[model samples]
Target chain A: MRRQVMDWLEERTGLETAVNHFLYEDIPASAGWHQVMGSVALFCFMIQILTGLLLAFNYAPTPGEAHSSVRYIMTEVTGGKLIRGLHHWGASMMIVVVVSHMVQVFLWGAHKKPREATWLVGIVLLLLTLGFGLTGYLLPWDNRAYWGTVVTTQIAAKSPGLGAQIERLLGSENGVGVVTFARFYTMHVMLLPLLTTLIVGVHIYLVRRHGIAPAPNDTAPKKKFFPGQVFKDTVAIFIAFCVLFALSVFLQAPLGRLADPTDTTYVPRPEWYFLFLFQTLKFFEGPLEVVGAHILPGLAIGALAMAPFIDRGQLRKVTQRTTAWGIALLAGAAWAGLTIAAMRSTPPETDMHAGLVDAPEWQSLSPEELAGLGHFRKQNCHACHVLGEKGKAIGPDLTASATKRDAAWHIAHFKSPAEVVPGSSMPPLTLPERQLNALAAFMLQLKPGSGASLDSAPDAVVNGAMVYQQQQCGICHQANGFGMKVGPALNGLASRRKRDWVVKHFYEPQMMVPGSTMPPYRLPKQQLQDLTTYLMELPARAPSRD
Target chain B: MLAEDSETSRRRFHLGVIYTLMGTIGAALGIPAAGYLLVPGSSNRKEEWVEVTNLEKLKAGEPEEIVFRRNRKDGWKILSEKTSAWVTKKPDGQVIAFAPSCTHLGCAFHYDEKHKNFLCPCHTSTFDLEGKPLEGPAPRALDRYQMKIEGGKILLGAVVKSQES
Candidate 1:
């Protein structure tokens, strides 16, 4: 029955013969493993298209919802993480395969004579692949992607005549916002994909027309493309997919905190493929940045496009084409060398905001101290002052400021910045007295390891109460006709749980209760003890009438 | 003739094995893709009544601010988020709860005893004791959450998005 259906369909559509002609080809026996890179690239692109379409169903492109939508996909949608991971890793794989394919084609002298148009088309494909990466990078709308795009568009703006216009077009008039996101999303999901697919069709047609370039010796036997070559390509694609699957399972695609345009502390870095260009910028300072950013790169691409014409050599063997091969090898080596050097020289981005938040120093802060830190961040003080590894060095480094000056000095400086430092550009703070005091306290606590020893004074209880209020611990734990009921009431905590256990729980709550949702305080050892002491003493107070 | 028939049968078996292997691979990929598409709609948050504070803590004709934490189960992750509400007891002893967010820009608004009004620091939006906007950028009254007194405890229901604000 299936054979009859197939025969009828074939007779009506003439599909069988057309498909046969499309699939079958003749090639040199010498076309071996190196010939498989193009097929592998195509395979990765197909994977990208499939996974990308799935992701697009759930992705929101607006600035407000992009990050949250991605978060939903990762945490709430089953197998969403796997699909996103494949798409993410597949992008890098595609670039790798395409670059290697280009390099192999170049070395084989396949771009010469009859295949110049094919070589140029391949170059355009390379650029389109890069375009895919650049546009897709911003779709996540995380801090890394936002800031990386900012730097790239700024680089684009360094062009001589139409620089500013390009910047304004890439970035909206008000800067990266709804308009910018919409533009990038359209290019990433629609324009670039359509353009790439069309170009790929043309590229394949050219390859079929020219056929695979034979080895220089021309002594190998001919082979049909169906069983031998197609099998090799299939194996290469399967191996590529296996590698991508393993990577996706083990290494999750990074999703940094949501994009905050106001956050200038974030250090922007591009993906590894662009590291060579990024490192090149460091050598060319202010005025000459355009040279490294645009001119040099443009010249390199121009040279590559003109290579076939410049050489015009009939020799395809590497031994006979010493000059061309040497130049290519040197360029490749330079890029690889620069990439390694950049990787080693630049500190890891993970350490950029360390010791500020999500670090031991931040967790150890008292409630009042934390409030002061919040005020500092809200006021954008980091834009000028250097705080730990964060912030630029435009103002004094505040890491050791506490050791050099007292709280009173900080208060005075905040009230009158120009009086404290001659010709200071900092504006005088006009916060309420309580907030100013909190800010001063926070600044004074910035000394290295200053809060390590919590002195148990006669007023330790009052300070502990302030810590409780600052941390908003009452939000979960109820006490004295106050607080919420999320956790157990602490009205008589001294009688309920052991003091030792309470102190240990503060350090690591999971150690006490495996499934407890209470986050670890991660406070200093002495502060933990003080908090436990305060909890133990809660029952001493008489119950207040409602 | 018998040898020829056996050879053809062996070839048929090999072809069948290849077809099965291909089908297995396709199913392995297609199942996850289908699951990913369907799972998000099934994984939705179900509202439950959560205890905010004891009714005894509130006094007649006075508003008290209460902050709490709630756990949101999103697929495999249980995320704890801090939430706050302003609880007020009327002269007749009826309870009311207003969400802490301002109507203008969603900033957390706090009651200022000195000013005798709820104020949002972000845009200086102000609301009265009855959760009505008094002045500034607030477009309407503060949003309210459904509440009830259960077993001497104040229970807050799902937050209702105010259409007016």
Candidate 2:
């Protein structure tokens, strides 16, 4: 029944003859493990395409959402992390396999005679694979990706006359933004893939036409590809995939913190494959930067592409290609040396792990104080003012700012810097009152040796107490067994009424209690809330005093 | 005839071993890949109750701010984040806490003694004494924290992330 179906289909489509002809090629029995690299590369590419397509279904291209979307895929989506891991590791595996395949082809002198086109196409494929790595590296939109792209684009911008144009093309006129992300996304997912597939198709066709290059000894028997070569290819591919799978499981892909353009602390380094190029840039400075950044690499690639014509030896043996082999070995050694040097200069992964571990001092900060610290960093306050280990001493040290000045004073200083400190060069800040207060709260907690303190004044309550003092609520109300006997004693007010009631009473004193002598404070909503927060907590404080 | 039969059986045994090895390798690759695909789905966000401050140290009408560390395990990495909250003791001995984030654009709001209100410096949003939004662009009052008083200490629950407006 199956034979009849196959015959029927073949009669209609002529598929059986075409497939038989395509699969029945003869290869040299000497074609051994070395020939399997190409098939392994092809296997890795197929995996990349499958996993990349799955990832694209979830990835967002926009700068604002890209990182968060990747986080969602890694942490939330089903099997998303696994698919992402495969794709990530597949890229590295493809590069390794492709490089090994190229080296094999070069060493065996397979680029000789009529196979010049195949060799040239292979070089282009090598570059396109690297291009794939470069473009995909930034799609995660994390700190590492962002800064790596930044460094590369800056290198591109050093190419003399054409440098500016390249920079503008890669980075938008305003810098890396929506335009850059969209362009990279399109190239990574659409254009590069389509172009790679086309070149790969031509490459495979050429391989088929030329057949596997004969071994230099030329003594081995020729064998059919169906069982012999096919089985070997299958075995190599399965083993390669097993390695990739183990890597994906054990060494899960890293997802760094979300990209922050303003962050200056993060150290940026390119992916491992690009470390050689990145290290090359450090050697050339100022006027000669182009030599390392562009000219050298360009010349190397040119030499590789022109190898077939340049090395016109009719013999296809390793001994005959001594000059070519020497040059390849020298280039390989240089790349390995540079990559190792770059790896050593950078902080080790252990340092990054240590950074990820929480410090004990962090837990001592109140929520407001923590936010204030974030504001301090975000506002670039460290540029002038010294605070602990961070910031410069151009301005006065803020370690004791809280003891020196009250929350009200800090708020006033932030609004008008020069007014607070006569002749102060500090720029006036336009932050809202809330941020100013949070900043003040953070500053207050920065006393010397205060890191050991387990107890911290809650920022809201401190601010609330400040509000009570500033509003002179003590003039009419008594609290904690102090102040006048007029109105209700706020010390136990929270016990009798909820926070909302107190807030409403502040807004309209007559609404909650009839004919009350307490005048409406006409305070803002947040102030009322703060005052109420303070009033509500007053009872809790009273018991402690007792 | 017996010699030929033995030769054929030896070849068959070798072929069987090769095929079995290939199958075992295939399974070794396939099983883990399948497990990795299911990892994201099975993973859960870890939350823990962290100590904020001691209750005896909180004075009446005075709010004390405290920060606690929380660790989130993401695959092979543990991310430690410091979270802060405003803790206060009421006159009746009831303890209350609020997240430091303002209901507005999440700028930390602080007490303004001169204005007698909680003020967001970013947009000038004001909240009255009760943590109610009195003015500005804040959509609601400050978010409150889940609190537990135990063993002479105040422990704060996982921060209640306010829904983005």
Predicted model with the maximum TM-score: 1
Which pairs of residues clash in candidate 1, taking residues 3 or more apart in a chain or in different chains? none
TM per candidate comes to 0.60, 0.57
Alpha-carbon shift of residue A20 in model 1 (angstroms): 0.7
* RMSD in Å for all candidates: 17.5, 21.5
Q: Tens-digit lDDT track for model 1 on A343-445?
A: 9986676632221122234333444554576577668887876454345545654643454777788889889989988899899999877677778877866
In candidate 2, position A384 carries an lDDT of: 79
In candidate 1, how many Å is residue A412 off? Answer: 33
- Candidate 1 overall Cα lDDT vs. reference? 0.75
Residues A457-529, candidate 2: write the lDDT tens digits. Answer: 3446555655675676667776655556676666657667887777777778788888988888887777677
> What is candidate 2's lDDT per residue for B107-128, written digit by digit as tens?
8877776776678899999876
Question: How big is the positional error of residue A163 in model 1, measured in Å on the Cα after superposition?
Answer: 1.2
**iRMS value of model 1?**
12.8
lDDT of each: 0.75, 0.73
Model 2 residue A168 lDDT score: 76
